[model samples]
Every structure is written in structure tokens, then in C-alpha cells.
Target chain A: MREDASISINEIQEQIIREMARLDDWMEKYEYLIDLGRDLPPMETALRRDEYSIAGCQSQVWLMPRMRDGRMNYVADSDAKITRGIIALVLRVLNNQPPRDIAAAELYFLDRTGLRSNLSPSRANGLAAIVKQMKAAAAARMNT
Target chain B: MVFTGTTYKKINTAQVLDVDKVRKDFPILARRVNGRPLIYLDNAATCQKPRAVVKRIVDFYTRNNSNIHRGVHALSERASGEFEAARETVRQFLNARSTREIVFTQGTTDAINLVADSFGADFLSKGDEIIVSGMEHHSNVLPWQRICARRQAALKVLPCEHNGRLRVEDLDRLITENTKLIALVYVSNVLGVRNPVEEVIRRARARGVPVLLDGAQAVAHFEVDVRALDCDFFAFSGHKLYADTGIGVLYGKEQWLRILPPYRTGGGMVQSVGPERVRYAGLPLKFEAGTMHVAGALSLEEAIHYLRKLGFDSVRAHQRRLMDYAEGRLRALDGVTVYASPSRRYGAVSFTIDGVHPYDAGLILDKLGIAVRSGTHCAEPLMRKYGVGGMVRASFALYNTRDEVDALIEGIRRVQELCGECKSTRSLQ
Candidate 1:
């Protein structure tokens, strides 16, 4: 986790965009994402239940949220490696932020990196779905 | 291009097809995707239209654009003549008894729903049973399920074997006095196995029960003779047979068609309407309610013409050769498992890589410009039968070649290499 909680979501998003732009081709970009996904800490088996599972995904995905010191954090995992890599990218930009910031953050990095187009729109569950769930979770916390 | 005797001789041999020549007829096959030549292996989902079918659609709208069956003008007569002629074409294609027996539907799903709704309304009651094979697509399963639920009837399943072939022996025992209908897929979309529909129809006939074969996948790869098979009803989609979507056929025996009420009732499907009661139209017209897909029906006629030009024997031989080669190559792979090793198969070959999720493999393959279907394939029960979340399918059509199958093999290897490390840690459960 980064020590600087003061960093804005836009700054983190720009950093991600810069990192992705460095890759020359789709293969290199995917390799980078695979490495990032592999480095993510594995979610506990106890939390990986059907209750946390998201529907409409081609593969199984589990997402859970936690509030740490009034900051919103998500723990997610997917059976598919590519989907996990995508979830990893999403978590990097939105994790460890306050509920309002997490809820209001614009995820432009996915579109800028051309990853959004790669995910088929017919599949209702993908990057867009994960972001919706995260934002909804953040919104739920705001009422408390 | 018009198919003449010379075209047949130039493109087809005794039991083989000149696939290179055949590929030229479908212009989309030439386009590139993701900087690579597109390898289309999703024929079971739908097929690419030939030049003849495309041109027929354009020709219909440009020259013969008029409402069919109701117009008194010259354009209307021409359009109506062409539309009914298309019906005759479908009648000949299926070897149906009469043109009146063929009903135009939206697709296979709509065709199945028509039979389920109309038949269920007329014949079914509390405790009546409908038998369907376990390997049927959702289109075949859900209609019966919903009707059974609505009418307080029972939906009985004839389960498939572990290898995905339906057990025909169990059919005799499953049918009883309560059984009103037997619906089965002529060819499974996912497993690619041809169910023993002939034997099934014969058995169902012995019990005085009618059989409806979902021929959405069968019509593309082989000839279908509804009369010879003695199936009470046969349904298929036009797009699967190299034509446009939203147009399909439902072939019902005239005896049954006379007794059953119309599935959908509206304009052009009525003889008269009065203040007290409305009298519906006769035979096929009673079933078609709204303005039909006139262009689609005509394109279907053209598609049938295209297939007849290629010859069904050649189409069957070409598909069998490709499937045999694909299954052999797939089985030789170290970490791949091919599903449903039936003696007779067509249109599709389903398999899964040992460690990688099918969606992951599908995505990586798409990046390489290879299009394959990678989900449950709308046959969730069949997926459950095989104890798999999903399987990757490489479906073939007459235009496909051995070289394309080779490319698919290579694409699978690349997917394995890219996602190999994640295999150990990935677990769906």
C-alpha cells in the first residue's frame, strides 16, 4: 500500500495511464497486467463464498469490501487470469480512498489504455461491472 | 454469381469441395482482424452469408419492395409471388409434405416457443409430461419448462451419458401414457453429437406421441427429410444455413396444424372478423401474425440454392474431415480435454484446456483474430452434465478448410503458453 493517502484519484489515474503508454503493443501491456495480477495478495478462502460472487461474468468473480480507518478498500478475485489482471488495475486506482472519493472517482484509465474496448460489451460483467459494484459499495458506506 | 453446371464441376469433385473456391464466395472471409486474417469458427452460433444471399437481399428491396399477400398493384403481386415461392423453396429444402405445412418464424427459439405454446394450449393439462433430452440448448429446454410450469404439467429429461451422447435406450422407458410430446435436438450445438432422432421419432410414433426435432444445427451440415423421419414437427433458423437472421421454418403435419389454434393471431392470418367472433386463416397463414421478414425468406431461398449447388454430400464430407482433424489435433495436446467423442458428430467440437478458464482462452484467441464461442453456449444443463463452467467450441462450416483448423491448434498453444503459470493458482470453486 502507498503511504501517501493524500494523492488524488486523478494523479493515480494519470500515473497508471503513463505506465500503460510505455508499453509498445497489446501483448506487452497484457504481460504487465498479468504480472500485476500475480503480485496481488490472494483473497482468503473463507471470504471467497457465493454470497460475494458477481453474476453475469463468464468466469467466477468474488468481491468484498472493508472499511479501514474510514477508508474504503476492496478485496476481489477472479478465476480467470485476464479478469484478475483487470480487477488489479481497477483496485490500484480506487483502493485506500475515502468513501466519497471512491464513489465519485472517474475511471478514465481503462478507456485511455484501450482495455475497455478489449472487453466485450455483450458480457455485462467486466471492468464496467466491477466499477459499478465498487461505487455502489462506497455509496452504501456514505449513509453510515 | 449464378451457379451453373460448369460452376458445380469447377468447385466440387465427387465427394470433396474446392474450399478455396468456396471461400471466395463469402467476401467477409477475406477481411483482416487484429492485424491477422480472421479465422471464423463460430458456425454453430451463425454462419457467414455468401454473395448470392447478400445480393438477393439487395435485389428484393430495390426491385420487389412491396407488402406481400395484400397488395393489388404489380409490385405487390411480384412480391407476394416471390414470398410464397420462398415458402415452396423451404418446403422442398426440408422435404416437407406440402408448402402449407411450413410456417415462417423468427428463429429456432421462436419456432420452439410456437410449438410449446400452441401444443401446450391444445393437448397439455395437469400431469401431462413433455420429454426433452438433457443436451438440448436453452431454446429447446426453456420453452417446454415454462409451458410445463404454466399448465401444471411435468417436464421429464432424458439424460445424456458422461461423454455427452443421449441414451436412446432410456427413451422407451421414459415415455408413458401421460407423455404428450417428445422434443429433442437433431444435432447438439455444444457437443456436436447427432442425437438418434430417427429412432426417437419412431419410438414416439409407436406411443401415438408427436416428435419435434430442433434442426437449427442440423440443416447447415446435412440434409433433413421431415417426411422420411416422420417427425411431427421440425424447426430451424435461416441464419444457421447461410441466410439472414429473424427468419426460420416450422414444419408441422397438416392433420395437427388443422386442429391446433394459431400461435399468434393478427393481420393476414384471418379469413374473417365479426363483432361476435373472429375466424382465423387456414394452414400456415394462421401462425404468421405480423408483417413477415420478406427479404429474409427470399435470402433463405438463395442460401438453400447455394447449399444445393455445393451439394450436401460434399458439405458433410468436408465438415467430417475438418472435425476429425481438429479432434485428433486437440486430443494430442498435453493439457487439453475434448468433450463428447461420439462416433457421429457435426458442426462443432467442444473442449477445455486443463488449467485455463475458457473465457481467458477465448479472449487470448480473439486477440489473435480467431473467433470462437467460449461460454456455456446457452446449454447450461449440458455444461453441468460435463461438470464444467464452460468449454471452448470451434464450430465449422462448409467454407472452412484444414488450414484454418491448424491455425486454431496454434492459437490454443499460444493461449496455453501465455496463461500457463496461472493454472496452478486458478480455481473456480
Candidate 2:
């Protein structure tokens, strides 16, 4: 089994929305975020060049989102497989959702995926960076 | 199904590798997995034990188990004899000059860390280069990286090609006089690419740079003759070789090991301890810091013997056939992508499906009773180079069969259907 199977897609948006709401300390929701990663569709490999890369991830990450039927459909890859899973979790709730909805995702899906319990603080920070990227993508989509 | 015709001929020709006789040796292969017969394809991760090896371990604990070298008692003598005898078996297996060249550790990771902490840190000053390939497992890559960070050595990487193969030229470009160590993985855990270690080692030797091989995946799939390969240092895990864990082999050129510092210093390794200073023991003893994994060493001997009896040529051909069969079947699937060609293939075949994420695929496969590995495979750089974040890896061994591959193919098809027609996601090339 993939070591990163801690999260599921269905829970990604829900966790993020809840975390935003601060229903529980975001610190308590690490596993949920990890689980959200479990179902992330990997970024397609064709975009592995320097342009699509996510900087500062312990493993390199490349994210590319396309507009399909006015919703965001993402193709992402990571030097770290688990990080790609994390990307999938972030994209599930944030992608192609309305800009306001994307920006305002009220749930911290990390809780639902049980991510907070097992991961390190650095990983937690990495998760936050990915979340920030997704939010940025959503905001850009909204403006577009 | 996962069946490959090459795998069939391999199993059939070795007729000695009969599924029934071979299957009997492995205790776990007989059991049910996920309610069906277990089809373990995770051999690259760790092989299940044969009764011969497992029975040896049980017998040691029941009959002659004791701390080795320290006690002059009968039990310690027997254990020490058996443990060191195991080292002799390994010495013959890898064809080293002496058993003293082999030092036991927790596993491959520890062995690599030993090289890093001992020789790597001591010799590699800042600005010196340590060349590694993109396909390294964290075990091989991380240690040198850490040691380089400490010693101010530069870490250089050799890129893998579309075929996932590393060329000699890439190594040529990466190596310079400043290249103190060139560490490469023997078999890629994810992409199944086999590096040209002999050529790499020969080339590096001429240049005065030491070469280390992470043989964790290769040792299980091929006949590893360290003297034949002539690598400076070789490391592998016992678990991957069908022996128990908590033990591994780190083989260095005896002359080289003599000069390098020890990895960990403690009671057993120390000949005598002055309050502020300690003198270390000799050879393998100097490296073993505590009471040894006596049983682990003994069982490792059994595992090596089992492989010798099995014969390397038959096993290699058998596993290659299985890989071809499985790769062909996986290729037939809609939206499935399998990388690394047969010419360069090891027992491992790593690929991805269009619609199913690797984890979901793993989950569904688990439910189907077929065991495989998924995710980055601790090879992030290699994964990134391939434009994938992760993949599902199905690796075989001497005991695996065409029928098991069939089960794997069917399970994959089941997951693919569940995820729906995913042509949009497909990339077989």
C-alpha cells in the first residue's frame, strides 16, 4: 500500500473548510490533510519541467490546473509521492469551486483525514503551503 | 491477468522452481490474504520467509540462542560460531576475500549510514563531491547528503533517461577528481531501472573515487558477487533476501574498512574503555557496537544457501518472464502507464493507472488479496524526472507465478472499471 494513503478525496474540501472555520485547532487536524493526499490524482508527468514546480517542498512538486467546464481540473506531480497526494487533497475542495467558495473553504479537512495526529510540525507547515497554493489557484481562477 | 509468457517459460523450464515445491517453503504464501489466496508482489520491499530460514531462526532461539563472543559458556560459543558461520556464508555468497569484510547492521539503511558516518564524513571535506544517481532510495541518498552537508562536500546527481536507464556518459560528466565517492543503487525500487554498476565502478576506480552500491532490491533478484562487481562498498537488507529483519550486510574492501572509523562505539566494539578514551576491536567486531543479532545472522546464512540451491540463472530468467508477462498485461489496460523496458528491467515493474490514484489502487488491490507497493517509492527525484508523483510497484521473486500475475491484472482492471473509462487519463507510452 502507498504509505501516504492516510487521506481521501471526499474529505479534502470538508477538512479545509472546517480548518478555516477553526472548529478545532488546525493543529489537531494533520492526518485529515494527509488522508486528503491519499486520493490526489498525481500531476501529469508531461509538465515535469521547471515551470510547473512548487518551490521549497522537501520534495519537488509540480502543479498544473486546467479549466474544464468552468471548473478546475488539476494535473500535478511531486518529487515526493505523498506530497502529490497532499496536492490532490487540496485540489479536491478548492479546484473549480467558485472563487469566493474556494477562498472561503470553511472546513479544515485535515481533521477528517486524521493528519494532525501523526505528522511532524514541518510536514504540517508543508501542508499549509500546499493549501495556500490551492487557495491562490482558486483566487486566480476567480479573477479569470 | 498479470501473467507473462516469459515468466511462464522461466517457471516451467526451471521445473525445479515448481510452484508447489517452492510455495511450500514460504509459510505465508499458503495463507489466505484478504479472504483469497495471498499473492505477494512486494518482494522488492521485503520477501516472505521460507520454512528453512524461518525454522532455523526458531530453532536457534529454542536450542542455542545466547549472546556471542563475550561469554565463554557453551551457548555463547555455539551462537558465536553459528553467527560468524553465517558471515562466512555471506562471504561466499558475495565472494568477498574474508568474512571479516562483512559487518552486520540493522538493515540497508543502517549500513549506508555507517559509510556516511564513518568513511564518508572523515574523508569528504567541503567542496569534495559525492556522486549519486536520481533513482536512489532514501537509504542511499540521504546519508551521503547529510554527510556532505556536514563535511562541505558537494552532492552531484546522474540523471536517468526516458528508459529510466542511467548511461555511462552521465556518470562520466558527474565524476571529477573531487568526486570522493560515487554511490548508486543496484536496482531501482520504483522504475525498475538497472544501473551499469560494473562499468561505473571500473571507471570510478581508475579515477580514485570510491563506489558504494545500495543492493537492497538487486540482491533478491540477481546473483550478487561483490568480488566480481568489485564495488568498494555494498549494502543490502536481510528482509529483502528472504531472511529476518534487524540484520543486514555492509561489505567493504577489507583494506579500506581497516582504516575507516567505526559507525557506533560502545561496549562490544571497544576492546577496553579508559574513562576518556577507548580502543576499538578488530575488523567486524569493531563495527558491531552491541550484543549481536545472533539469530538474524544465522538465518541470513540459511537464506543465502536457499538462494544458492535455487540457482541465480533460473531465478533471474523466471522473474524476468514474470515481469514481461505482467508488463504486457498492464499495458493492455486502458489508461495504464508502465515504464522501464525489458532490456533494463529487474524483477520490479512500477506503473500507474489513469483514473485511480496509487493509494486507491493499493486499497482496492488489498481488498482483492494481491499485495503490491504504491507511492513515491522513496525516489522522489526519479519520480519527478518521470513526470509522476508516485507509482504502483509489483516486484517478483523466485517463488512468484503466472497465476499470481493474473490475479494482479484482474484486480487492476476491477479498480480501473470502478474509476470508469479514463482514456483522458491514459498514457501507456
Candidate 3:
């Protein structure tokens, strides 16, 4: 799939939901996620420090955000593959989008993929934290 | 199905538990998680409550619900009688000298905090030392840490061995004249190793230092005789013993409870309160303040009765078989590291798989309807000592079976396979 700036956040989310719908069971869905996580570009080692880490996650997650040409770009990584995969999915929808779009975007694709359970606040898997951090970062950029 | 009257008699006669029969008593066991039969291996977190316990709670709320120790009416007197009777049950359960020794609290954490606050305030002074083990759950560690900070006392630690044993031999050097209290876990929640607490208690006694055993993990697996152990203090949670949450026991010696001032003060805990000064109530009531968890206490009593009916011999034997099978099966698997494979283990077996994070394994296991605990299991210091971020723990209970262990083993293999495929396919990509 091309990283097209022309695609809207909802369109990408729909695309993700449609892609996830093709998987028959949780195993296949997880496998697809694992592949996505494995393919994600590694975050710069210097940026993966304690300051970038999210608290309350069972796995160690580091999320770093940058603004490029009035758009948000997030570089995130997790020690756990499943969490990394979940973050990869989140970034797929929001990455390179305008800060306003990123901030206001509703992540319905996570629920559609049957992966929302992992994003529960009680689960503390870092997906929820990642999404919150991404939006908060975008909102912060909008003020500047 | 209420295991109240005749069912007790039936269970007492049977030497070993009918495992299936025992499993039936816990309603949650029959339910499915995800799409498969639930394999609950997280008993160390909290055991499933039996029907008798639930019924006891409901029965109390339905009929004998009233403020205890205050009311002169029929319901109040009945409620107070049953509440004190629950204390007596706990007293008998731990074989304490009197009901005076059994003080109720919210749970193990609350009990420990009670002791730390009361005892530390009364006994500890600047430069006085308190000893705790490296493997203690944060509950055991944090209370003493706070108290020590307040008292300006030193907190000494008995380091855990590489193989997961507390270094008991170091107690002589650690237990100086300045040592006020030695708090330790009776069972390691992470390693499953039952610490050599008896020897530590004996050694501490000789040195005139009081010892507190955090028996939160111990009480559920075996019988605890406070008199036999001769420890100054023992703390355990009711929920871990198949009873309700929000109730626990802090068994103190008569001498200790007599001197340790009240932890919380309120309406129920006072003999009289005047404008100028106040007089505290005696013994157990001094510690129990306000309207207690009357239902929780009553349910705990029923849970004890239920356990006594099943018999500790049976519980021990069954748990032993499951642990042995689980340890054997887990040890057989390649690329798995079982922490603290001590000669004596109880309740939980914690480990990690190579190239697979414990969190990921837990996620997959949850999907398969096999519940497990991952991450540090609330013992981060121990995890740091072992040089791991987290571990997968499968903790067993009386209702848990060899079949569940088999399921856990299979589930672990599935985790390894799924995570392994991700790596292999990634290498190809």
C-alpha cells in the first residue's frame, strides 16, 4: 500500500478494517499484526529512552512524535510484538496526517479489528497510551 | 448444593477430594472464556469463591444484617454473636491462644499496614533496623519502607540467592540488637519457593527480635498454626482462601496485641471518649474500627469450614500433584526458564520463554481461555535481581487440576509457535 498524503484518516481506517476483515480467526489476525509490527521501522535508539516511555503498560513502549510540514509523524516501538503490532496499526491511520486531523480522528478501526479489548484501560497494553500520546502530541503541536 | 450441613460430613469422611466435586462448588469454573473452557491458573492473585461462601454472605445480608457490638436489639446481638464467632473460627483456624489475637483488617496489605503503623510507632526508634527479604511482594516491602522512613530506622534486606532461596544463614549478622522487626514472605509469589520462615522465626526469637510472616500466599495452600510456628505476627487474606475479598486476619501474640496500640480509631474501637481525653477498647476491638465487613467475616468463617471439610491433607496432596506435574511439564519444554525451582514450592510456578515476552504469552493464553499472570507479578525487585523485565506465572488452587496444567503446557507451546512464526516469517521478509 502506498503512503499517500491524498488518503484521509477515515479512508485509511476503513482500509485497515477491510484488510483485517479478510482474516478468519484471532490467530490469523494476530499473525497479520505480527507481520505489520515486524515490518515497522525501528525507532532511533537515542529516542527510546525513559522520557519517551509510557507508564502502566505491561510491556515497555516508547513513542516519539515529530511534525513535518504541518503534519504529525509518530515513531513508536514496544518490547512486546503484539503491542508493537497494535501501535503499528494506530500509526497506519494517523501517521503523516495533519495535527488537527490526528487530534480529532476517532480510532474506530481498533474496535472493528476485534483488537479493542487489548486497548482497554485495564489491560494496560500501551495501545491506549500510544493513541492518547499521539493525539496529545498533535494537540500540543496545534497550539504552537 | 450448600455445603453447610450434611455435605460437611460427606467431605470429612472422604480422605481425598473428589476433584470434580470440588470444582463444581466454584461456579466460575464451569464458564467459558473466549471460546474454550476456562483454565484459571491465576489463583495466586485471588482464588475463586465457593458456593458456600457466597451463600453465607447472601444469608447474612438477607437475615442478620445489623451494626455489630453496638445494638442491643435481636438482629444486632445475633450479628455481633456471628461476627465474634467468625473471629473465634479464625482463631481456631490459626490455632491462636484466643480470639483476642485475631484482629480483622481489609486484606493482607491492610493487615501489614496496621502492624507497620502501630508496631513501628510504638516500638521502633531512630537507627532501629527492620529486616525484609528481597523476594517480598511490594505490599510487604512498601509498608515497612514507609514506617522505616518515618521512624528514621534502617531497613535491612536479606538478599535472595541466585536459585531463589532467602539467605537464612545471614540472619545472625542481620539481626543486631537494633533490629526491631523482621518481616518476610512465607511463600514467594514469583518463585513459588516457601521460604524457610520457621528457622528465621526461631533465630529471630533467640535474638529477642519480633518476626512478621506475610502468609498471604501460604494460608491458601496449607494449614498455618501460629502457635506451632511461634511467630509474633502472621498475616493472610481471606479471598486467597476461597473466601470473600475485603477481609483478612492479622494473628498477633497476646503479648504483642496488648502492647501494639490501635491502628485505626473510630466509634466501635473506643471504650469512652471525653472532651479532654479518650480511652481505647481492649485487644481485637481496639484494632477493628467502625462498622466492619460483617458479611465478609461471616463468609470467611464459612470458607474455613468448607476447607476443613475438604481436609488440608487432601488439599496438600492435590496441590502437590498439580505442582509436580506442572513443574515437570514446564521443565521438559525447551527455551523456558523456571525461576527458583526449590525443593519445596507452593501455589505458583513462574517462568519465561526465550524470544517470547511474558506479556505476549499472557495475551495469547488469554485468547485460548487459559488465564495467567504476566509482568513482574508485583515483585519488581526480584525481577530486577533475575535480570528480566517480567515473567509468566501459572498459579494453582485446590480446584485446579492436572488437566489444567496440561492445557497451560499446550498453551505455552502455542505461544512459542505463534511468536516463532512471526520471527521466521520476518527473517524471510
RMSD of each: 4.2, 9.8, 4.1
List the candidates' TM-scores in order. Answer: 0.94, 0.75, 0.95
Per residue, candidate 3 scores C-alpha lDDT tens digits across B147-212 of 999999999999989888789999999889899999999999888899988999989999999999
User: In terms of TM-score, which candidate is strongest?
Assistant: 3
- CAPRI-style grade of the A/B interface in model 2: incorrect
Best by DockQ: 3
What is the lDDT, from 0 to 100, of the residue B159 in candidate 1? 90
> For candidate 3, lDDT tens digit of each residue in A21-79?
88877777777777788879888888888889886547878898999877888889998
Write model 2 residue lDDT over B361-428, tens digit each, in one string. 66457657889987778888887888875688899888888788888998888766644432223211
Candidate 2 ranges with C-alpha deviation above 4 Å: A1-144, B1-15, B421-429
**By TM-score: ranked, best first:** 3, 1, 2
Clashing pairs in 1: none
- What level of docking quality does candidate 3 show? acceptable
Q: TM-score of the candidate numbered 3?
A: 0.95
lDDT of 1 at B52: 99
> On lDDT, who's better, 1 or 3?
3
Q: For residues A104-144, could you state the per-residue lDDT of candidate 1 as single tens digits?
A: 88888888998887555636345556678899999899766
In model 1, the runs with Cα more than 4 Å from the true position are A1-5, A119-126, B1-15, B422-429
